[model samples]
Target chain A: MSKIIEIKKLRKVYGDGVELVALDDVDLTIEEGEVLSIVGPSGSGKSTLLNMIGLLDTPSNGEIWLKGQNISKASSKERARLRNKELGFIFQYHHLLPEFSAVENVMMPLLIAGVEKKEARHRAITLLEEVGLGDQLNNKPNQLSGGQNQRVAVARALAGHPSIVIGDEPTGNLDSKSSDMIYELLRKLNREMNQTFILVTHDMDMAEKTDRILRLVDGKIVCEMLRDGDKFVTRDLCKLDK
Target chain B: MLELFVAMKHIRTRKRQTVLAVGAVGLAVAIIIVFRSLMNGSFETFFDIFFELAPHVLVLPKEGEEYIYLYKTLIEFIWAIPGVAAVSPALSTTATLSFEDNVENVDMTGVVPAELNKVTSIGDKYMIEGDLYAIQSGRRVALGDKMIEKLEVQMGEDVVASFPDANTMNLVVAGVFRTGVEEWDQAAFVSLETAQEFLGDGDVITYINIQIEDPYQADEVAAEISALGYDAESWRTMFPQFEESLAFETFSNNLILVLVLLIASFGIANVMNMLVLEKTREVGMLMAMGTNQSQIRRIFLIESGILGLAGGIFGTAFGYLVSAYFNSLQYTVNAPTAPQPIVIKFLVDPFDLIAFSLLALILSMIAGVYPAHKASKLDPVVALRG
Candidate 1:
């Protein structure tokens, strides 16, 4: 599989005088059409790794190669352009602007990229329909249910056709039914469009469903697994002792 | 353009704040227009003092130069000049008109019947029980409107005017003349021959009041008159104090305008700054959406300019209404000289309106600069989080 996002010796540090590492010499490679999930408890750097993938936070010591460019040292304007045109983000909270209707909120990314308004609106409507939000396109975020708002956020993130969709707890605020719906939507989009997805979630049950899983503890990945065909396995599952 | 449109939406959403901003701009424009109008009034007053007090130019007796008695010779010579409008000679004297129980001081002007209407317009507006042309036609004296009240003399009744040269003469009350101005309304006008007769000078005159075809040409005519050995003075030369007063008014008005401009600019600055602070998150979103810094700044600039233009238009309309109402009101001064209120017309010149609009716009734009810059400099990451 071709790598869509590549990271090498990635390090993330917080605070000034005495720096604390959120990511310690981490290396990652996410391939096209891969549904990858980063699972960890609190303070396990799952969010920091997700942020680095989305280009929202910079690496302290590493190079991030996206598609074919070394984008780690890109100027702020260049980074903003790339973010607008090539990246989409979904946070733990469905951050749809309260003032805009679902379709308008979805159109934000397209409008920010200087797309014509009519075209952006057209695309946003189609995307809302794809996300089962056709009836709620004109409804504001406050008027929509938790599941509907999250669906709008998903539509917004996909509006610009970004190569990689990174979600930090996209279903963290939803009920179990809404979470199931979001997880199915993410998996279905990954299969239909063959787009890369990197999600950070605390729910291990949801994490176990992705094609690949990276479990971290104390800012370091302790185990990495890849589902083969339709089987779920760990390093011990394929051992002769099993 | 989208940023500006969104910014406009934001401004419109908060109507109360928008009104405050526009009101500040309106107040500034109002003050500017009023001061401009008052400045114009000051200019008109100055021009009047000059036109009424002095002719365009003055021809005077060169020091120790006696008029080689050129009234007849000079009149024929000056009337032939292309610029000379009309030339009249008058014998002037100080006298007191006394009735049965009243007496008042007067500058008695002995004017020729042909030149009486040409020298001053005060004679045209004022009339007592008798008529001016009737008085000038017969052997009658015209008393000023002020003298009529003081002397308590009736038309067709005779009064005794005693001249400084000791000639006491009995002249019938001809008419009363009033022009509002104290100087013209207080002076008595009579036939020049009658005045010369009263002053005991049959031919000698006090001075000549010359009117050129165009008051603008008065200077040239006066110069020529001086060459003929006579003294000529324009209205401005006569009353230097009124000119000084007009100049003082101009200076003070300019000072007030500067202060008001500063205050107006400050109001705009304060409002824009608050707007920037309040809308930081929106600004970040715009920046993240690929809006450049300069473009973001233009959004706020348009907002400020719109406010200024609207306020200016409102202020101008308001000023016109206020001035029109003020002008229509009868202002009673009850000045002992002219008892009735003189109608003052407040003229609104176009340049005054244009200047006021331009000044408010410039000040508002200046006020917008700092806040716009701050908004443009905002970082999308930090600002969005904030």
Candidate 2:
């Protein structure tokens, strides 16, 4: 498969007064239609790498590419536009706007992409159907359960039909049964719709099940593994003992 | 437009706060409108007194430092002017009257009994206790209301009137008259011939009261009379000091208008600032959705503008209602110079409403500028972080 996202010699530092390196000399290439996982302990720089690829944060040096576009040098607005059209992001907290309904939250990415209201609604409904929560579309985040709201957030991240999805512990707030369901859904979409997945998680058995896994420790890639089928947030929710 | 609806929804949701802000604006507008109206109404009402109760033009003695017993030439000259309504000649002098040692100083005016009807109707209304024809017959004289009260005398009571020439003559109380003024109500009206004889002017009159077609033409008539070498004065000229008082009231009213607008501007600014603060995250969300800075600014400007415009319209109506309420208060006042009602009447101009509304909207728009700029400057990444 051809590489769809490339990160070359990327480094991210925090603080102006005292330097803290969140990502250090990281180089990565994610192929088209690939399902990849970056797994590590709590402070192992996996989430920071995910942020750099998602364009939610810029690397201090080096270049990152998304599809055919060089996105490392994109302006803040350009980054927003790219995120709206070419990528989908799901975070552990479900980050659905508390003021909006589940469907409206799902429609957000399409709206951000400048899709017309009706068209955005239609696509949001379709994505919600894909996530198996079509009946819950009108409910707000507060009105819905944990697993339900996370599914809605997942539906939102997929609404614009982006080629790639990046999830940072997307099911961290969910029960084991819900985590299994979410992992199954992501795998199904990855295989059927040819969507690429780059997820950061602490799930060891789940990482061993993915098509590729890069393990990190103390701001460095310590190991890598290649496998198939599924990966879930935190391997403790996995079927490893089964 | 959609954004405005959303903002309005937020405002409506916070009913108490919105009402307080709107009430502030409404109260300011109402007070301003009523003040301007009452000032205008009183000003108009005050001028009407001169036209209705006093002469529009007066032709007086033209000679230097001499009393005018007769200004026949000036009276005839003014009577021929195009807008002249009627002219009556008059002579007046002060004399003391006594009924058994009760002496009252009386102002005696000599006027043609028939022509004087056009100026006032005191002679027609009063009764003569001696005889109906006594005043015209020159056999008896009239007594004032206050004089009767002081002298404790009935009509037909024998009275002695003494003039400046040491002439004390016996007469009967012919009648009593009232002219709605304390001073005029006390004055005695005798036939011009009788008064001329009493003052010893010998058929010459002192001044002429020339009624003009319109009260506004009083100044022009007075100027024409002046050109003819007569010292002509209009009612307005007679009340220069009164007019000066009214002018001061107008200045104070304008000062109050400034104070209200300044305070109302602060209210509008505060509301707009709150709106901008509340919508910060929403604005950031919109910016991340690829909306430009101008679109974000337009949303806020349009939002505050709607608030301002609605406030202005309601405030103007509120002002009108307050003025109308003032108009309803019609108790009469008895001022020493010119009596009036205890209440103020409402009067307004459409121009005043339009000007005040525009001023309010401009203030609201000015208040929106900084907040709008702040919203537009938000960066998407930092905004979307949470």
Candidate 3:
């Protein structure tokens, strides 16, 4: 399978004098159709890494290659175009605009891509139905439950039919039942469309379900786990000795 | 298209704020339109009175001379001027009129009645008693109503008129006229032959009044007439004080308009700033969804544009209705120069309407810029953290 994304020597430093390294000397690659999870504790740079890969932020010193282009040196306009055409993002909080209906929210990415309104609407409706929100298409984010809103976000993330989707603790705000349902839905969509997903989460069980996992500790990948059928084989390198 | 849709949605979601911003602009536009219309109406009325009561151009002798010596030749020369509609020769002097025990000082104008009537509308419409031809025969005089009353003399009675050169004559009061102007009503008119005879000057006249084909072209005609070795004055040059006052009125009116529009623009700016602050999270979400900074700026600009358009339309309609209502009222203004109170009517100029509305629109759009810039420059990561 072709590599969908590659990162080399990624380093992100915050503040000038008393510098804090968010991601230090990181190297990573995501293959096509890979379901991957990045697990880390608070302040461990999981979100920072995902942000760099999603083209939402620039690394201080690194090169990020998305599909074949070096996006780290890309212009703002070029970055935005790549982000819109090739990548989708889901935050910990469902960021569906409260003023828009479910279908309207789902159609946002396609609309941003300059698709015709009528066609965007038709595609958005199909995506929403796939996410089991067919009957709630006209409901606004405020009117829907938290779990339902997250599902709407999922549908929105896929509206542009991007090659890769990035999620930052997408199910962190939901209950166990809702989290499980979201996980099942994401897996079903991933297998059906062969779209790669990079999820950042603290939930170990959710991390174990993915095809591969990378454990981050203090801005460095300490351990990696690969799934074999129904089991996860762990390779531990560093311990949190505080 | 998406930018417009999002912009409209933002405005629709914040109904109260949008209405208040729009109302501020509307009120400013309406006030400016009403004030300007009234000022224009007053100026127009004042000029209308001048055009009706006086000649468009007047020709006088060269400096240090009291009369045009070759008066008949000058009159014929002026009559042949291209734009000259009519020319009437007149001799004016301060004189005293006495009838029995009553005597009053009056300004007397001597004119050829037939020629004067063609040059001015003062004769036909303002005649209260006798005809304009009554003064053409013999040593007859046509007195204004106020002058007749002051002298306590009846029509057809004789009055002793004495000129500054100690020349006196007994003139019959043939008619009484009222021009609805106090200054004009206090004057008396007689034939040019009688005036020259009374003043003991042979065939000499003080000035010649010329009416032109187009009143607005008075300056060019006056310049042409002045080239003929005479001092020619257009109505504007004749009334410098009135022109100064008119200019000052226009300047103050425009100043008020700018001040009002400035205040309204601040109101719009304040509303948009608040909206930007309130929607910071949504802005972040949009940016994260791949909306460029220019697109975000366009959205806010479109919002302000919509507000301005709505306000301009509403204010124009409201102003027209209010001006119409004012015109329908029976209010009158009393002035010292006018014999009767003049009725007030608001004169709305289409140019003023278009100008004020366009100014308001531009101001509102300018007000949107700062807030739109702030919104566009917001960092998506920091905004999402909020």
Candidate with best DockQ: 3
- Residues B1-386 of candidate 3: C-alpha lDDT, one tens digit per residue: 89998988888888999899889988888887788778877887887677776888989997889898898988888877787888999998777999999999988888988778767666777788887788889889999899988989998899999956857999999888898778888998998888888888788899988888877778988898788779999987887787798899899889978898889888889988998898898888888788888888988888887887677767777887788788789569989767568877787898877877788788888999999999999887887776
Report the Cα lDDT for candidate 1: 0.73
Compared with the true structure, what per-residue lDDT tens digits does model 1 show for residues A131-175?
998888789888998888898888888898988888889999988
Give the TM-score of chain B in candidate 3.
0.81
Candidate 3 per-residue lDDT, tens place, A1-242, comes to: 99989999999999989999999999988899999999988999998899888887899998999888888988767877887898888888999988899999999888888999999999999999999999999999999999999999999999999999988998999999999999998899899999999999989889889999998987898878888899887766545352
Candidate 3, clashing residue pairs?
A: none
Give TM per candidate: 0.72, 0.63, 0.87
TM-score of chain A of each: 0.94, 0.91, 0.96
Minimal lDDT window, size 10, model 3 chain B: B117-126
User: Candidate 2: lDDT over CA atoms?
Assistant: 0.72
Which pairs of residues clash in candidate 2, taking residues 3 or more apart in a chain or in different chains? A203-A235, B68-B206, B69-B204, B69-B205, B69-B206, B70-B205, B333-B340, B333-B341
Write the candidate numbers in order of decreasing lDDT.
Answer: 3, 1, 2
Q: Can you write out model 1's per-residue Cα lDDT over B1-386, one digit (the tens) per residue?
A: 45555556656766777788778777777766765765675476445434443344444444574422446666688679896655666666788888897888788877764554555434454454566666555457887666777787777888888956657888888777666566766777778667767877556665666666666566667667666556666645565676578678778987788688668768778888898898776566555444557777887887777667666777777766665565566333434544344444465777767777777777788888999889888876566555
> Candidate order by TM-score, highest to lowest?
3, 1, 2
Docking class of 2: incorrect
Report model 3's TM-score to 2 decimal places: 0.87
Q: Where's the lowest-lDDT run of ten residues in candidate 1 chain A? A: A233-242
Give all candidates' CA lDDT scores: 0.73, 0.72, 0.87
